[model samples]
Target chain A: MTINEIQDQIIEEFAQFGDWMERYEYLIDLGRSLGPFDERHKTPEYLIEGCQSKVWLYPSFEEGIITFTADSDALITRGIVALLVRVFSGRTPAEIVDARIYFIEKIGLRENLSPTRSNGLLAMMKQMRLYALAYKTKQEHS
Target chain B: MKLAKSIEEIRSDFPILSTKAYGKPLVYLDNGATTQKPLQVIKLLEELYRTTNANVHRGVHYLSDMVSERYEAARETVRAFINAGAREEIIFTAGTTASINAVAFSFGERYVREGDEIVISGMEHHANIVPWQMLCERKKAKLKVIPFSDAGVLDLEAYRSLLSERTRIVAVTHVSNVLGTINPVKEIVAEAHRHGIPVLIDGAQGIQHGMVDVTDFDCDFYVFSGHKVYGPNGIGVLYGKAEVLNELPPYQGGGDMVANVTFEKTTYNVLPFKFEAGTTNFTGAIGLAAALDYISLLGREAVTEREQALLARATTGLSAIEGLRIYGTAPQKVSLISFLPGAIHQYDAGMILDKMGIAVRTGTHCAQPLMGRYGITGNIRASIAFYNTEDEVDALVKGVRKVTEMFA
Candidate 1:
């Protein structure tokens, strides 16, 4: 699905939930569905910086599209990473590069997340985009 | 000795104190984390932003001059608050963390060498511990920690043994945030000086509880946050000894801190300005000064007595509760309590209390090392301030009792 379609579906699913707790549970379940990541992908180099929770994201390119699999020690943060991955993963490098996903405001994360968590989320997004940019550059070169 | 008015009258000054959560009035007991600002502090900030707002020290406009005057006056107020030698010794920074980082970056970089020792106590806030660790890592200096007893009091003998000729600096907290043990800073300073090592006291938790005269303590440096002392957030004071401040390099390079700057060598400004490098929190500093004025008018002795009474009430009340274990039962304590209940997560208790409109802090409180020392992941910290009352303590106890009963 397109990023906007996925976001709309997630929002619709969230809207069906009565309260924050149910929405949170849905988010966590979504994260669980992303399945497990490998041990090699769990190193400090791939670890998202400045988060109270430990989160790791690893990206790979397939036919000029970037796909990412991420994991986190914290359930909520894992869910957050999952949301980010859903929005950006499997998208072409150009699409990912053009996307200015307001993930924080959209997910209603800022009010719940601490300043550290918010900064960490920003850093994670930046890293993902950087990865996408590199992939795009490499694709052009090839 | 009763003040002219009851606590109800004083409570009116704080809007948050009267706020209701889940059908109950908010009984705020998390002053150690940060105190609720008074209406006066709030109004002062609003007024500064609404009426007279401008950048300080650079512009030649009228509003700028007015802002500069208020900002400098705040410095003078802080100087008098701590009884520093002069206004030039007080450097305005973001908060205690920034203030300490300034010291660590400047002095720690210059003086500390490989194999030199930097000593700190077990109960320091992360702000005090991490900067020194970073400094030690960079300079290849060894960081020595002064061990504490199981009771959470500093083992002075252990502290003494840790100090040596190689000890370049001794950084300690004036009061323990978790334990509430007020350290004998004067004694620590004297001991460190005997070894010819300068000391920096993290007074972030101290300034509100009691008086701190930098001259009386004779320490090399002192730091505290305005927010913790009923002032506005994002403003902190760094008081350095004149001679020591003169020697250290500037922390940040920017507009006000420099006298003249070219691409080549930069000539820095005077003492306080040299450290303060960016556009400061002018409103916050002014509001903090107003807070100081308010606090001074309230009288330190009155504030201290009221806090002591509140602590006594809380400890006695909590002692009566079953299965509740209180940490930091040191003989000398300020107005705070950290405790755990049998088979209850601290976060759960905190959430429960929040639901009942009783605000208390739960978690490591940015003092994870101290939590590790106590062999607990986290605890519920109920800290009191002078403005708090026995009634609030009653409410907190009642809330905890409800939680215990529900869990049981």
Candidate 2:
């Protein structure tokens, strides 16, 4: 599916829930499914800067597809980054970079998230895009 | 002394107390950051803009005279509130940060020299620490720190050893924002004075919880923000001793602060005005006076007692929570509580609590050095004011329990 199609699916899943509790539950469940991050990749170099909570995102490319894994100290922020990793991983550098992720706003996450958490989510996405950009440049040079 | 109104009555005077935060009534426990203004202060602010609006200290017109009088009258109110020696000692600035910056520059210019030392405590807010650090860096002087104990109280023996002939000034917080430890500032002042050094008390957190009489504290200077004590932002008070202030050079020179100006040289204005550069926040001054009036009418002793009861309840209730470590355990402390619950991170717990409509501050509380001293990144801080109630305390305890379970 396209990036928009995947985001639309997320919006539909969120629409089935009525209140904040259900949305949070869904996010926490998503975070739990992300499994344990490699202890070596949890260093300061992999950490996303400008985040209110501690978040680490590690990216690697294989067979022309970029894969990402992430973790956060805050439960809500962890869950939000987990969602980003789920949607962006296993995609080509161009696809990950060009894809527009509107699911956050469409699912009312933009308005519902606190100012601090919202900034963290945006920072997490920016870090992922940066990784994709680096891969895209590296492939062109080769 | 009789309170003009009860706790419920005072709570009613603050309209924000009635506002809901996520479909639940907002429980504001972040008084240490800033206070919610009462309706009296809010109405006074509106009345000033509506009825009396003009530039102060310059105009010959009626509106100017009216505002000028009110602005200076607000200075008098602040003087009376802190029991400052004279109105000339109270210099108004943007807020606590500006006030401290002014003192740091002026004092450094007059006293701090190469090899000079300025001592500050570990629990000082960044407002108190950064200014001295800048001053020290500029003057080639040294900034010395007085570390605190595990229980969050400063060691006076360490403070005494730190003070010496080369010490210029000793700056410390009257109350710790993160740990909620109320230091023995009076004793600290005396110790510094014995070494022929001066002291400045950061009263940003101290002014509201109890009486802050400068004469009794007897420090060389006392500073606090208006917003922390129910006033509007962009206004703060710097209460320096008259002789000490007269000696230090002016902070910023502009229209109001200058007495004479020439291309070659200029003469500065007298005390208070010498420090107040440019046009001041006249409306903010008036609003601050109204807030002081609100507290006065409520009666200080009565308000302190009521707040004490609420604090005691909260401390006891939260102590019952298993694995909840309350950071500051000083017996002399009051009102505020900062804690780390179990293995739960402060951010996750704060998020869960917010969904339930309970408001609390979670982070380093701007005392990062103190956090480092305690070997933690941050924790949750719930600071109370007199307007808060036992019911709200109960809600906080219950909310904390739920948040811990949710994260677990």
Candidate 3:
């Protein structure tokens, strides 16, 4: 499926929520469902600094698709990154680079993200695509 | 309770309270960060642009005189607001950061020397900490911190021992932004004075919570931000005693701050103007006066009663929750309550609260050292104001409970 289609599906799923409480409960559930990040890879190199909470994102290129791994100690931030990961993971480098990730705002959740964490979300997306761009360059050369 | 009754009516003067966030009523508890401007201040901003718009101090034009009159009048309002000794003592700057930076630069140059020590408390916003750090580095001086108790009160004994002939100036916050602990600035000032060292009180969070009588408080300098006090963002007050201000060299040299400018030799302008420098935010200054007037009408005692009552409500409600630890347990606090719920990251709770239309501050509250001292990275701070109601406090307590529940 296209990135836009996946994002659209997520937005539609979010729109079903009647209120913020239920929506956050859903996000928290999604966060808990994320398998524990391998501790070895949770190094300073993968960490995104300046977030209101600590976030670690690890990425690798496999079969020309970007495989992104991420975690945050804070559940809400973990949930927020989960939203990003769902949108961008398993995509080809070129596809990841071009995806707008507008589903956050489209679902009205972007407005609800606290100012500092919102920055962290943007940083998380930016890093994912940067990884994608690097993989795209590697594929182009090799 | 009487104050709360009147405050419900007072809340209407602020237009944002009537607005909604998502589907819920906006529960604004971030007044420590910035205040919602009253309609009086907002209208004054509009009126200034509509009618009283001109460059101040330079032009002999009628509009200039009128603009200058209002700008100076605003300075007088600030002077009265903080009970500053003289009109000349109140220097306008961009905000509390600017106000502190001016003193740090000018005062540091004049007094701070190599091997000299500048003492600040553990609980200071970066605004108070960074500028002094800069000055210390530039002057090859040492920076010292006065420790605070676990309950968030400054250790007065530690402070007394820290003072010495090497101590040039003592800078401390009158209130902790994170803990909401109101320090004994009067006592701090007295100690600094005893050592013949000058004290600068960072009143950025101080003035809004209660009456500040600079004459009685007798600090060498007092500083506060305008936005935190329901005024415009671009304006702040730096209240220095006339003699102390005269001792420090002018902070920035520019058009208005100079009496005469010759390439070879230039003389600076007088007291307040000497610090003002370039084109000031005259509109912001007018709005600040209007905000002060709004506060004055409500009366400081009433505001205090309402804010304290709300804090008590919030503290009680949140304490009922299991595994919640509040920071800054000083006997005298105002306007703010910050806590860390068990096993929940402050960001987790804060984001959930935001989603529910309950605005609270998360993270370090700009007091990183204090956070480090407490062995935590951040906290959820829900600071109330006179405009806030007990119902909103309940919303916060309920929201926090839900946050813990979802995370658990």
Candidate 1, residue B264: CA error in Å? Answer: 2.6
Candidate number with greatest lDDT:
3
Cα lDDT tens digits, model 1, B1-408, are: 444446777788888887886577778899999999889899988899898999999899999999999999999999999999989999888889999998999998779899999999999989999999999999999999999987888999999999999999999999999999889999999999998899999999999987889999999999999999999999999999989999998878898999999899899999788988889888989999999887887777778888899999999998899999998888888999999776565754665677678899877888989998977767899999877878889988888887776555
Tell me the deviation in Å of residue B173 in model 2: 0.3
Alpha-carbon lDDT of model 3: 0.88
Per-model DockQ against the true two-chain complex: 0.06, 0.56, 0.72
lDDT of 1 at A81: 78
Query: Per-residue lDDT tens digits of candidate 2, residues B1-408?
Result: 456797778888998999899788888888888999999999998888899999999999999999999999999999999999899999998888888899999999988899999999999989999999999999999999998888888998999999988899999999999888889999999889888899999999999988888998899999999999999998988999999999999988789999889999999999889998899998998899999988988888887888788899999999999889999998878699999888787877777778888888887788888888988878899999989988999999998988676667
Which residue pairs in candidate 2 collide? none
Which numbered prediction scores highest in TM-score against the true structure?
A: 2
lDDT of 3 by residue, A1-142 (tens): 8999989999999999987777878888887887678899888899886548777999877888887888988776677788788878898999998887788888777753445454366677778888888999999999
Candidate 1 positional error at A63, Å: 31
Q: State the lDDT at B105 in candidate 3.
A: 96
Error of 1 at B26 (Å): 0.9
DockQ: which candidate is best?
3
TM-score of 2: 0.97
Return the DockQ of model 1: 0.06
Name the lDDT value of residue B227 in candidate 2: 98
